[model samples]
Target: MTMESATDAAPLRTQTVAVKSSFYLAMRILEPARRDAMYAIYAFCRAVDDIADDEGDRAQRREALDQWRYDLDELYAGRIRPRSAFLAGPVRRFGLDRADFEAIIDGMAMDVEEDICAPDWEKLELYCDRVASAVGRLSVRAFGLVDDGAKELPTAPKLLAYHLGRALQLTNILRDLDEDAARGRLYLPREALEEAGVSNHAPHAVLANPALDQVCAPVMSRAREHFEQADLVMAGLSKNAVKAPYLMAAGYRSILDGLTARGFAPPRAPVRMSRRKLVGALLRHAFL
Candidate 1:
Protein backbone atom coordinates (compact mmCIF):
# COMPACT_ATOMS: atom_id res chain seq x y z
CA MET A 1 0.00 0.00 0.00
CA THR A 2 1.08 3.53 -0.65
CA MET A 3 2.16 5.65 2.32
CA GLU A 4 -0.89 7.90 2.15
CA SER A 5 -3.18 4.90 1.86
CA ALA A 6 -1.63 3.34 4.93
CA THR A 7 -2.03 6.50 6.98
CA ASP A 8 -5.46 7.43 5.70
CA ALA A 9 -7.25 4.17 6.39
CA ALA A 10 -10.92 4.60 7.38
CA PRO A 11 -10.44 2.55 10.53
CA LEU A 12 -8.73 5.54 12.06
CA ARG A 13 -12.03 7.44 11.92
CA THR A 14 -13.86 4.60 13.61
CA GLN A 15 -11.19 4.50 16.30
CA THR A 16 -11.52 8.24 16.86
CA VAL A 17 -15.21 7.75 17.54
CA ALA A 18 -14.50 4.97 20.00
CA VAL A 19 -12.23 6.97 22.28
CA LYS A 20 -13.44 8.75 25.41
CA SER A 21 -16.29 11.05 24.45
CA SER A 22 -14.53 14.22 25.56
CA PHE A 23 -11.34 13.41 23.71
CA TYR A 24 -13.28 12.36 20.65
CA LEU A 25 -15.15 15.66 20.77
CA ALA A 26 -11.94 17.66 21.00
CA MET A 27 -10.20 15.64 18.31
CA ARG A 28 -13.15 15.91 15.97
CA ILE A 29 -11.83 19.36 15.15
CA LEU A 30 -8.91 17.66 13.46
CA GLU A 31 -8.97 16.27 9.95
CA PRO A 32 -10.20 12.72 9.84
CA ALA A 33 -6.80 11.23 9.07
CA ARG A 34 -5.05 13.15 11.83
CA ARG A 35 -7.90 12.53 14.26
CA ASP A 36 -7.60 8.78 13.79
CA ALA A 37 -3.96 8.42 14.86
CA MET A 38 -4.42 10.99 17.58
CA TYR A 39 -7.35 9.07 19.03
CA ALA A 40 -5.54 5.74 19.14
CA ILE A 41 -2.48 7.26 20.81
CA TYR A 42 -4.61 9.29 23.22
CA ALA A 43 -6.72 6.29 24.17
CA PHE A 44 -3.66 4.39 25.26
CA CYS A 45 -2.11 7.41 26.90
CA ARG A 46 -5.34 8.23 28.71
CA ALA A 47 -5.54 4.70 30.07
CA VAL A 48 -2.01 4.85 31.43
CA ASP A 49 -2.50 8.34 32.82
CA ASP A 50 -5.78 7.36 34.49
CA ILE A 51 -3.90 4.69 36.35
CA ALA A 52 -1.65 7.37 37.78
CA ASP A 53 -4.29 10.03 38.37
CA ASP A 54 -7.21 7.87 39.39
CA GLU A 55 -8.15 7.81 43.05
CA GLY A 56 -7.65 4.24 44.17
CA ASP A 57 -5.30 2.02 46.06
CA ARG A 58 -1.68 2.90 45.30
CA ALA A 59 -0.89 -0.78 44.98
CA GLN A 60 -3.77 -1.17 42.56
CA ARG A 61 -2.49 1.66 40.41
CA ARG A 62 0.99 0.19 40.31
CA GLU A 63 -0.39 -3.21 39.47
CA ALA A 64 -2.59 -1.75 36.75
CA LEU A 65 0.31 0.10 35.17
CA ASP A 66 2.35 -3.09 35.21
CA GLN A 67 -0.42 -4.92 33.45
CA TRP A 68 -0.66 -2.06 30.95
CA ARG A 69 3.00 -2.34 30.14
CA TYR A 70 2.68 -6.06 29.71
CA ASP A 71 -0.30 -5.58 27.46
CA LEU A 72 1.69 -3.09 25.42
CA ASP A 73 4.51 -5.61 24.99
CA GLU A 74 2.04 -8.21 23.87
CA LEU A 75 0.28 -5.81 21.49
CA TYR A 76 3.54 -4.86 19.84
CA ALA A 77 4.69 -8.44 19.53
CA GLY A 78 1.31 -9.66 18.25
CA ARG A 79 1.59 -12.38 20.85
CA ILE A 80 -1.90 -11.93 22.26
CA ARG A 81 -4.33 -9.98 20.16
CA PRO A 82 -6.00 -6.93 21.59
CA ARG A 83 -9.76 -7.10 21.38
CA SER A 84 -11.47 -4.41 19.32
CA ALA A 85 -12.59 -2.33 22.23
CA PHE A 86 -12.50 1.44 22.58
CA LEU A 87 -9.54 2.66 20.52
CA ALA A 88 -7.63 -0.59 20.07
CA GLY A 89 -9.01 -1.36 16.65
CA PRO A 90 -7.53 1.69 14.96
CA VAL A 91 -4.07 0.96 16.25
CA ARG A 92 -4.24 -2.51 14.80
CA ARG A 93 -6.03 -1.54 11.60
CA PHE A 94 -3.75 1.42 10.88
CA GLY A 95 -0.66 -0.63 11.61
CA LEU A 96 0.66 2.09 13.88
CA ASP A 97 4.29 1.46 14.76
CA ARG A 98 4.76 -0.22 18.11
CA ALA A 99 7.65 2.03 19.14
CA ASP A 100 5.41 5.07 19.70
CA PHE A 101 2.98 3.01 21.73
CA GLU A 102 5.84 1.64 23.85
CA ALA A 103 7.16 5.16 24.44
CA ILE A 104 3.75 6.17 25.83
CA ILE A 105 3.73 3.14 28.13
CA ASP A 106 7.24 3.99 29.24
CA GLY A 107 6.18 7.53 30.09
CA MET A 108 3.10 6.50 32.06
CA ALA A 109 5.08 3.87 33.93
CA MET A 110 7.55 6.58 34.93
CA ASP A 111 4.70 8.63 36.44
CA VAL A 112 3.52 5.60 38.44
CA GLU A 113 6.97 5.04 39.96
CA GLU A 114 7.03 8.34 41.81
CA ASP A 115 5.13 11.51 42.63
CA ILE A 116 3.56 13.43 39.78
CA CYS A 117 5.81 16.35 40.58
CA ALA A 118 9.52 15.95 40.02
CA PRO A 119 12.17 17.96 41.90
CA ASP A 120 14.14 19.24 38.93
CA TRP A 121 13.87 20.58 35.39
CA GLU A 122 15.67 17.56 33.96
CA LYS A 123 13.16 15.25 35.53
CA LEU A 124 10.33 17.43 34.25
CA GLU A 125 11.64 17.27 30.70
CA LEU A 126 12.01 13.54 31.01
CA TYR A 127 8.44 13.36 32.15
CA CYS A 128 7.19 15.54 29.32
CA ASP A 129 9.14 13.53 26.78
CA ARG A 130 7.61 10.27 27.87
CA VAL A 131 4.03 11.38 28.39
CA ALA A 132 3.41 14.13 25.87
CA SER A 133 6.25 13.90 23.38
CA ALA A 134 5.63 10.24 22.79
CA VAL A 135 2.08 11.03 21.66
CA GLY A 136 3.33 13.77 19.36
CA ARG A 137 5.79 11.38 17.72
CA LEU A 138 2.99 8.95 17.10
CA SER A 139 1.06 11.81 15.50
CA VAL A 140 3.89 12.41 13.09
CA ARG A 141 3.60 8.82 11.99
CA ALA A 142 -0.09 9.27 11.32
CA PHE A 143 0.57 12.44 9.33
CA GLY A 144 2.42 10.35 6.76
CA LEU A 145 5.86 11.84 7.21
CA VAL A 146 8.35 9.10 6.44
CA ASP A 147 12.04 8.70 5.78
CA ASP A 148 13.60 8.07 2.36
CA GLY A 149 13.17 4.33 2.81
CA ALA A 150 9.52 4.77 3.85
CA LYS A 151 10.23 4.17 7.55
CA GLU A 152 8.97 6.89 9.92
CA LEU A 153 11.04 10.01 10.35
CA PRO A 154 11.74 10.55 14.02
CA THR A 155 14.00 13.34 15.20
CA ALA A 156 12.43 16.63 14.10
CA PRO A 157 8.92 15.57 14.99
CA LYS A 158 10.18 14.18 18.28
CA LEU A 159 11.66 17.54 19.30
CA LEU A 160 8.59 19.39 18.14
CA ALA A 161 6.27 17.02 19.97
CA TYR A 162 8.36 17.25 23.14
CA HIS A 163 8.07 21.03 23.35
CA LEU A 164 4.35 21.01 22.64
CA GLY A 165 3.93 18.45 25.39
CA ARG A 166 5.98 20.61 27.76
CA ALA A 167 3.87 23.64 26.99
CA LEU A 168 0.66 21.73 27.64
CA GLN A 169 2.04 20.27 30.86
CA LEU A 170 3.12 23.69 32.05
CA THR A 171 -0.37 24.96 31.38
CA ASN A 172 -1.67 22.07 33.43
CA ILE A 173 0.69 23.08 36.22
CA LEU A 174 -0.50 26.66 36.23
CA ARG A 175 -4.14 25.64 36.10
CA ASP A 176 -3.96 22.92 38.73
CA LEU A 177 -1.15 24.18 40.93
CA ASP A 178 -3.33 24.42 43.98
CA GLU A 179 -4.99 21.05 43.54
CA ASP A 180 -1.70 19.29 42.86
CA ALA A 181 0.02 20.89 45.83
CA ALA A 182 -2.86 19.88 48.04
CA ARG A 183 -2.16 16.33 47.00
CA GLY A 184 1.48 16.66 48.09
CA ARG A 185 2.69 17.31 44.59
CA LEU A 186 4.37 20.49 43.45
CA TYR A 187 5.15 20.62 39.77
CA LEU A 188 6.82 24.00 39.98
CA PRO A 189 10.56 23.66 40.25
CA ARG A 190 11.80 24.87 43.62
CA GLU A 191 15.14 25.96 42.20
CA ALA A 192 13.59 28.03 39.48
CA LEU A 193 11.37 29.92 41.91
CA GLU A 194 14.23 30.48 44.38
CA GLU A 195 16.36 31.87 41.59
CA ALA A 196 13.55 34.29 40.86
CA GLY A 197 13.47 35.32 44.53
CA VAL A 198 9.89 34.17 45.03
CA SER A 199 8.62 31.72 47.60
CA ASN A 200 6.17 28.90 47.06
CA HIS A 201 6.51 26.85 50.19
CA ALA A 202 2.88 26.21 50.97
CA PRO A 203 -0.15 24.87 49.14
CA HIS A 204 -2.05 28.14 49.32
CA ALA A 205 1.00 30.34 48.74
CA VAL A 206 0.22 30.80 45.08
CA LEU A 207 -3.10 32.33 45.98
CA ALA A 208 -2.09 33.74 49.34
CA ASN A 209 1.34 35.25 48.78
CA PRO A 210 1.51 38.88 47.71
CA ALA A 211 4.66 38.07 45.78
CA LEU A 212 2.85 35.42 43.78
CA ASP A 213 3.59 37.07 40.47
CA GLN A 214 7.22 37.43 41.33
CA VAL A 215 7.43 33.73 42.16
CA CYS A 216 5.58 32.81 39.01
CA ALA A 217 7.60 35.08 36.72
CA PRO A 218 10.28 32.48 36.22
CA VAL A 219 7.78 29.67 35.81
CA MET A 220 5.83 31.70 33.27
CA SER A 221 9.01 32.48 31.41
CA ARG A 222 9.77 28.80 31.13
CA ALA A 223 6.24 28.16 29.93
CA ARG A 224 6.67 30.86 27.31
CA GLU A 225 9.82 29.19 26.04
CA HIS A 226 7.96 25.92 25.60
CA PHE A 227 5.06 27.76 24.00
CA GLU A 228 7.36 29.36 21.47
CA GLN A 229 8.93 26.04 20.74
CA ALA A 230 5.47 24.56 20.12
CA ASP A 231 4.67 27.36 17.67
CA LEU A 232 7.76 26.47 15.67
CA VAL A 233 6.67 22.87 15.55
CA MET A 234 3.19 23.85 14.42
CA ALA A 235 4.67 25.58 11.41
CA GLY A 236 6.44 22.37 10.47
CA LEU A 237 3.49 20.01 10.47
CA SER A 238 1.12 19.36 7.59
CA LYS A 239 -2.03 21.49 7.42
CA ASN A 240 -4.23 18.63 8.53
CA ALA A 241 -2.30 17.97 11.77
CA VAL A 242 -1.87 21.62 12.64
CA LYS A 243 -5.51 22.41 13.41
CA ALA A 244 -5.90 20.08 16.39
CA PRO A 245 -2.69 21.18 18.07
CA TYR A 246 -3.38 24.79 17.22
CA LEU A 247 -6.72 24.61 19.00
CA MET A 248 -5.01 22.90 21.89
CA ALA A 249 -2.40 25.65 21.93
CA ALA A 250 -5.02 28.39 21.83
CA GLY A 251 -6.63 27.00 24.97
CA TYR A 252 -3.26 26.74 26.69
CA ARG A 253 -2.15 30.20 25.62
CA SER A 254 -5.38 31.55 27.00
CA ILE A 255 -4.55 29.96 30.35
CA LEU A 256 -1.15 31.59 30.33
CA ASP A 257 -2.68 34.93 29.45
CA GLY A 258 -5.41 34.42 32.00
CA LEU A 259 -2.85 33.64 34.69
CA THR A 260 -0.96 36.81 33.90
CA ALA A 261 -4.16 38.81 33.91
CA ARG A 262 -5.15 37.35 37.26
CA GLY A 263 -1.75 38.21 38.74
CA PHE A 264 -0.55 34.65 38.40
CA ALA A 265 -3.03 33.34 40.89
CA PRO A 266 -3.34 29.56 41.04
CA PRO A 267 -6.54 28.53 39.40
CA ARG A 268 -9.45 29.59 41.58
CA ALA A 269 -11.81 28.84 38.72
CA PRO A 270 -12.17 25.97 36.33
CA VAL A 271 -10.13 26.43 33.15
CA ARG A 272 -12.38 26.15 30.18
CA MET A 273 -13.16 27.27 26.64
CA SER A 274 -16.61 28.47 25.83
CA ARG A 275 -18.87 26.81 23.30
CA ARG A 276 -18.43 29.72 20.91
CA LYS A 277 -14.69 29.23 20.99
CA LEU A 278 -15.07 25.53 20.33
CA VAL A 279 -17.33 26.23 17.43
CA GLY A 280 -14.91 28.73 16.01
CA ALA A 281 -12.19 26.10 16.14
CA LEU A 282 -14.43 23.63 14.40
CA LEU A 283 -15.24 26.08 11.63
CA ARG A 284 -11.60 26.98 11.23
CA HIS A 285 -10.71 23.34 10.83
CA ALA A 286 -13.48 22.80 8.33
CA PHE A 287 -13.01 25.91 6.19
CA LEU A 288 -9.45 26.98 6.69
Candidate 2:
Protein backbone atom coordinates (compact mmCIF):
# COMPACT_ATOMS: atom_id res chain seq x y z
CA MET A 1 0.00 0.00 0.00
CA THR A 2 1.13 3.49 -0.73
CA MET A 3 1.44 6.39 1.69
CA GLU A 4 -0.91 9.35 1.54
CA SER A 5 0.21 12.39 3.45
CA ALA A 6 -2.03 13.84 6.13
CA THR A 7 -3.34 16.55 3.85
CA ASP A 8 -4.52 13.93 1.36
CA ALA A 9 -6.31 11.97 4.11
CA ALA A 10 -9.30 14.33 4.38
CA PRO A 11 -11.80 11.57 3.74
CA LEU A 12 -10.57 9.63 6.77
CA ARG A 13 -10.51 12.75 8.90
CA THR A 14 -14.12 13.52 8.04
CA GLN A 15 -15.38 9.99 8.60
CA THR A 16 -13.77 9.68 12.01
CA VAL A 17 -15.10 12.93 13.45
CA ALA A 18 -18.51 12.19 12.03
CA VAL A 19 -18.69 8.98 14.05
CA LYS A 20 -16.95 10.19 17.22
CA SER A 21 -16.21 13.83 17.79
CA SER A 22 -15.25 13.05 21.40
CA PHE A 23 -12.45 10.77 20.29
CA TYR A 24 -11.39 13.29 17.69
CA LEU A 25 -11.17 15.94 20.39
CA ALA A 26 -9.02 13.73 22.63
CA MET A 27 -6.80 12.87 19.66
CA ARG A 28 -5.91 16.52 19.14
CA ILE A 29 -3.02 16.12 21.56
CA LEU A 30 -1.12 14.37 18.77
CA GLU A 31 0.73 16.18 15.99
CA PRO A 32 -1.11 16.67 12.70
CA ALA A 33 0.48 13.70 10.91
CA ARG A 34 -0.12 11.36 13.83
CA ARG A 35 -3.64 12.77 14.27
CA ASP A 36 -4.37 12.02 10.61
CA ALA A 37 -3.13 8.49 11.04
CA MET A 38 -5.30 8.06 14.12
CA TYR A 39 -8.32 9.33 12.19
CA ALA A 40 -7.62 6.81 9.43
CA ILE A 41 -7.45 3.91 11.86
CA TYR A 42 -10.65 5.01 13.60
CA ALA A 43 -12.40 5.20 10.24
CA PHE A 44 -11.31 1.68 9.39
CA CYS A 45 -12.68 0.38 12.67
CA ARG A 46 -15.90 2.35 12.26
CA ALA A 47 -16.45 0.81 8.83
CA VAL A 48 -16.32 -2.80 10.05
CA ASP A 49 -18.33 -1.94 13.16
CA ASP A 50 -21.04 -0.42 11.00
CA ILE A 51 -21.44 -3.83 9.38
CA ALA A 52 -21.99 -5.47 12.72
CA ASP A 53 -24.40 -2.77 13.89
CA ASP A 54 -26.25 -2.33 10.61
CA GLU A 55 -30.03 -2.70 10.65
CA GLY A 56 -30.01 -4.34 7.23
CA ASP A 57 -29.82 -8.05 6.41
CA ARG A 58 -27.38 -10.07 8.47
CA ALA A 59 -26.08 -11.91 5.42
CA GLN A 60 -25.16 -8.68 3.70
CA ARG A 61 -23.39 -7.45 6.84
CA ARG A 62 -21.42 -10.69 6.99
CA GLU A 63 -20.54 -10.29 3.33
CA ALA A 64 -19.29 -6.76 3.93
CA LEU A 65 -17.15 -7.85 6.85
CA ASP A 66 -15.78 -10.68 4.74
CA GLN A 67 -14.87 -8.27 1.98
CA TRP A 68 -12.87 -6.20 4.48
CA ARG A 69 -11.15 -9.32 5.71
CA TYR A 70 -10.12 -10.05 2.13
CA ASP A 71 -8.93 -6.49 1.73
CA LEU A 72 -6.87 -6.78 4.93
CA ASP A 73 -5.24 -9.89 3.60
CA GLU A 74 -4.28 -7.93 0.53
CA LEU A 75 -2.92 -5.18 2.78
CA TYR A 76 -0.45 -7.58 4.39
CA ALA A 77 0.42 -9.34 1.16
CA GLY A 78 1.77 -6.12 -0.45
CA ARG A 79 -1.06 -6.04 -3.00
CA ILE A 80 -1.57 -2.33 -3.37
CA ARG A 81 -4.43 -2.25 -5.87
CA PRO A 82 -7.31 -3.72 -3.80
CA ARG A 83 -6.66 -1.86 -0.56
CA SER A 84 -8.97 0.91 0.63
CA ALA A 85 -7.71 4.42 0.09
CA PHE A 86 -8.38 5.58 3.68
CA LEU A 87 -7.03 2.46 5.41
CA ALA A 88 -4.07 1.91 3.12
CA GLY A 89 -2.48 5.23 3.96
CA PRO A 90 -2.36 4.84 7.74
CA VAL A 91 -1.60 1.11 7.74
CA ARG A 92 1.35 1.76 5.47
CA ARG A 93 2.48 4.99 7.13
CA PHE A 94 2.29 3.67 10.69
CA GLY A 95 3.30 0.07 9.95
CA LEU A 96 0.18 -1.12 11.82
CA ASP A 97 0.08 -4.78 12.71
CA ARG A 98 -1.90 -7.32 10.68
CA ALA A 99 -2.65 -9.30 13.84
CA ASP A 100 -4.35 -6.39 15.62
CA PHE A 101 -6.52 -5.62 12.61
CA GLU A 102 -7.41 -9.28 12.21
CA ALA A 103 -8.33 -9.59 15.87
CA ILE A 104 -10.72 -6.64 15.53
CA ILE A 105 -12.31 -8.18 12.43
CA ASP A 106 -12.60 -11.48 14.26
CA GLY A 107 -14.46 -9.70 17.02
CA MET A 108 -16.92 -8.25 14.49
CA ALA A 109 -17.40 -11.73 13.00
CA MET A 110 -18.27 -13.09 16.42
CA ASP A 111 -21.18 -10.64 16.61
CA VAL A 112 -22.41 -11.96 13.23
CA GLU A 113 -21.83 -15.63 14.07
CA GLU A 114 -23.21 -15.67 17.59
CA ASP A 115 -26.23 -14.16 19.26
CA ILE A 116 -24.83 -12.12 22.14
CA CYS A 117 -27.40 -12.63 24.82
CA ALA A 118 -27.05 -13.44 28.51
CA PRO A 119 -23.32 -14.18 28.19
CA ASP A 120 -21.21 -15.34 31.10
CA TRP A 121 -18.71 -12.92 32.56
CA GLU A 122 -15.88 -14.86 30.99
CA LYS A 123 -17.52 -14.74 27.58
CA LEU A 124 -18.01 -11.00 27.83
CA GLU A 125 -14.36 -10.56 28.79
CA LEU A 126 -13.30 -12.56 25.75
CA TYR A 127 -15.44 -10.33 23.56
CA CYS A 128 -13.96 -7.23 25.15
CA ASP A 129 -10.44 -8.57 24.66
CA ARG A 130 -11.01 -9.24 20.99
CA VAL A 131 -12.77 -5.98 20.16
CA ALA A 132 -11.62 -3.33 22.61
CA SER A 133 -8.12 -4.46 23.59
CA ALA A 134 -7.14 -5.23 20.02
CA VAL A 135 -8.26 -1.76 18.95
CA GLY A 136 -6.27 -0.32 21.85
CA ARG A 137 -3.14 -2.09 20.66
CA LEU A 138 -3.61 -0.59 17.22
CA SER A 139 -4.49 2.89 18.54
CA VAL A 140 -1.44 3.26 20.74
CA ARG A 141 0.71 2.80 17.65
CA ALA A 142 -0.86 5.91 16.15
CA PHE A 143 -0.37 7.78 19.42
CA GLY A 144 3.41 7.35 19.06
CA LEU A 145 3.80 4.48 21.48
CA VAL A 146 5.64 2.49 18.82
CA ASP A 147 9.24 3.43 18.10
CA ASP A 148 10.59 3.79 14.55
CA GLY A 149 6.95 3.67 13.32
CA ALA A 150 6.97 -0.14 13.57
CA LYS A 151 4.08 -2.53 14.22
CA GLU A 152 5.33 -3.95 17.52
CA LEU A 153 4.79 -2.29 20.89
CA PRO A 154 6.95 -2.36 23.98
CA THR A 155 5.45 -4.30 26.86
CA ALA A 156 4.36 -1.60 29.31
CA PRO A 157 2.40 0.84 27.16
CA LYS A 158 0.94 -2.09 25.25
CA LEU A 159 -0.45 -3.50 28.48
CA LEU A 160 -1.78 -0.08 29.44
CA ALA A 161 -3.47 0.29 26.09
CA TYR A 162 -5.33 -2.99 26.47
CA HIS A 163 -6.62 -2.17 29.94
CA LEU A 164 -7.61 1.37 29.01
CA GLY A 165 -9.49 -0.06 26.06
CA ARG A 166 -11.43 -2.33 28.41
CA ALA A 167 -12.27 0.57 30.68
CA LEU A 168 -13.52 2.73 27.84
CA GLN A 169 -15.50 -0.10 26.26
CA LEU A 170 -17.25 -1.02 29.49
CA THR A 171 -18.20 2.60 29.92
CA ASN A 172 -19.70 2.45 26.44
CA ILE A 173 -21.61 -0.70 27.32
CA LEU A 174 -23.00 0.86 30.44
CA ARG A 175 -24.04 3.98 28.60
CA ASP A 176 -25.66 2.00 25.79
CA LEU A 177 -27.53 -0.58 27.88
CA ASP A 178 -30.92 0.81 26.92
CA GLU A 179 -29.94 1.28 23.30
CA ASP A 180 -28.55 -2.25 23.08
CA ALA A 181 -31.67 -3.60 24.76
CA ALA A 182 -33.79 -1.94 22.09
CA ARG A 183 -31.76 -3.89 19.53
CA GLY A 184 -32.37 -7.19 21.38
CA ARG A 185 -28.90 -7.49 22.85
CA LEU A 186 -27.92 -7.63 26.50
CA TYR A 187 -24.30 -7.68 27.58
CA LEU A 188 -24.77 -8.11 31.32
CA PRO A 189 -23.92 -11.71 32.20
CA ARG A 190 -26.77 -14.12 33.03
CA GLU A 191 -25.26 -15.14 36.34
CA ALA A 192 -24.93 -11.60 37.55
CA LEU A 193 -28.40 -10.69 36.40
CA GLU A 194 -29.87 -13.75 38.09
CA GLU A 195 -28.08 -12.92 41.30
CA ALA A 196 -29.66 -9.50 41.30
CA GLY A 197 -33.22 -10.86 41.08
CA VAL A 198 -33.44 -10.56 37.35
CA SER A 199 -35.12 -13.92 36.76
CA ASN A 200 -36.20 -13.19 33.20
CA HIS A 201 -33.40 -12.67 30.68
CA ALA A 202 -35.58 -10.94 28.13
CA PRO A 203 -34.30 -7.51 27.17
CA HIS A 204 -37.46 -5.75 28.27
CA ALA A 205 -37.60 -7.69 31.50
CA VAL A 206 -34.03 -6.82 32.33
CA LEU A 207 -34.59 -3.24 31.30
CA ALA A 208 -37.56 -2.91 33.59
CA ASN A 209 -35.82 -4.48 36.56
CA PRO A 210 -35.40 -1.98 39.36
CA ALA A 211 -32.08 -3.46 40.43
CA LEU A 212 -29.97 -2.64 37.41
CA ASP A 213 -27.02 -1.43 39.45
CA GLN A 214 -27.11 -4.60 41.50
CA VAL A 215 -27.06 -6.71 38.35
CA CYS A 216 -24.39 -4.61 36.64
CA ALA A 217 -22.29 -4.13 39.78
CA PRO A 218 -19.69 -6.74 38.91
CA VAL A 219 -19.05 -5.41 35.42
CA MET A 220 -18.73 -1.87 36.70
CA SER A 221 -16.29 -3.07 39.34
CA ARG A 222 -14.25 -4.82 36.69
CA ALA A 223 -14.20 -1.70 34.56
CA ARG A 224 -12.81 0.30 37.48
CA GLU A 225 -10.12 -2.31 38.07
CA HIS A 226 -9.01 -2.07 34.47
CA PHE A 227 -8.84 1.69 34.72
CA GLU A 228 -6.72 1.35 37.83
CA GLN A 229 -4.44 -1.08 36.06
CA ALA A 230 -4.23 1.33 33.16
CA ASP A 231 -3.06 3.98 35.59
CA LEU A 232 -0.30 1.75 36.86
CA VAL A 233 0.76 0.62 33.41
CA MET A 234 0.63 4.09 31.87
CA ALA A 235 3.39 5.27 34.17
CA GLY A 236 5.83 3.75 31.71
CA LEU A 237 4.84 6.03 28.84
CA SER A 238 6.67 9.27 28.10
CA LYS A 239 4.92 12.52 29.04
CA ASN A 240 3.68 13.43 25.57
CA ALA A 241 2.50 9.92 24.77
CA VAL A 242 0.48 9.76 27.97
CA LYS A 243 -1.72 12.79 27.20
CA ALA A 244 -4.24 11.20 24.86
CA PRO A 245 -4.76 8.13 27.01
CA TYR A 246 -5.11 10.32 30.08
CA LEU A 247 -7.67 12.47 28.37
CA MET A 248 -9.59 9.41 27.26
CA ALA A 249 -9.60 7.79 30.67
CA ALA A 250 -10.58 10.95 32.49
CA GLY A 251 -13.33 11.78 30.04
CA TYR A 252 -14.80 8.30 30.15
CA ARG A 253 -14.49 8.19 33.90
CA SER A 254 -16.69 11.24 34.17
CA ILE A 255 -19.27 9.45 32.11
CA LEU A 256 -19.03 6.43 34.34
CA ASP A 257 -19.31 8.75 37.30
CA GLY A 258 -22.45 10.23 35.80
CA LEU A 259 -23.87 6.73 35.47
CA THR A 260 -23.12 6.11 39.12
CA ALA A 261 -24.74 9.37 40.07
CA ARG A 262 -27.88 8.11 38.34
CA GLY A 263 -27.74 4.94 40.47
CA PHE A 264 -26.27 3.03 37.52
CA ALA A 265 -29.66 2.78 35.88
CA PRO A 266 -29.79 3.91 32.31
CA PRO A 267 -32.26 6.76 32.00
CA ARG A 268 -34.94 6.94 29.33
CA ALA A 269 -32.82 9.56 27.62
CA PRO A 270 -29.20 9.16 26.63
CA VAL A 271 -26.61 10.67 28.95
CA ARG A 272 -24.10 13.15 27.69
CA MET A 273 -21.61 15.64 29.08
CA SER A 274 -22.00 19.21 28.08
CA ARG A 275 -19.20 20.79 26.10
CA ARG A 276 -18.24 22.92 29.07
CA LYS A 277 -17.96 19.87 31.28
CA LEU A 278 -16.06 17.95 28.65
CA VAL A 279 -13.68 20.85 28.12
CA GLY A 280 -13.11 21.09 31.86
CA ALA A 281 -12.32 17.39 32.10
CA LEU A 282 -10.02 17.64 29.09
CA LEU A 283 -8.08 20.49 30.63
CA ARG A 284 -7.64 18.69 33.93
CA HIS A 285 -6.40 15.58 32.20
CA ALA A 286 -4.11 17.43 29.78
CA PHE A 287 -2.52 19.63 32.43
CA LEU A 288 -3.20 18.31 35.90
How many clashes in each candidate?
Answer: 0, 0
Q: What's model 1's overall lDDT?
A: 0.63
Give candidate 2's whole-model lDDT. 0.76
| lDDT digits (tens) for residues 155-199 of candidate 1 | 666666777777777777777777776665667776666765555
Alpha-carbon TM-score of each model against the true structure: 0.78, 0.90
Report the error of model 1 at residue 280, Å: 4.1
| Runs with alpha carbons beyond 4 Å of true place in candidate 1 | 1-26, 31-34, 81-89, 92-97, 116-118, 145-150, 196-207, 274-288
Model 2 TM-score on a 0 to 1 scale: 0.90
Clashing pairs in 1: none
> CA lDDT of 271 in candidate 2?
65
Q: How do the residues 88-206 of candidate 2 rate in per-residue lDDT, one tens digit apiece?
A: 66677677887888888888887877558889888888888888898888888878778746646889868987799899888888888878887788888888998988888987788
Clashing pairs in 2: none
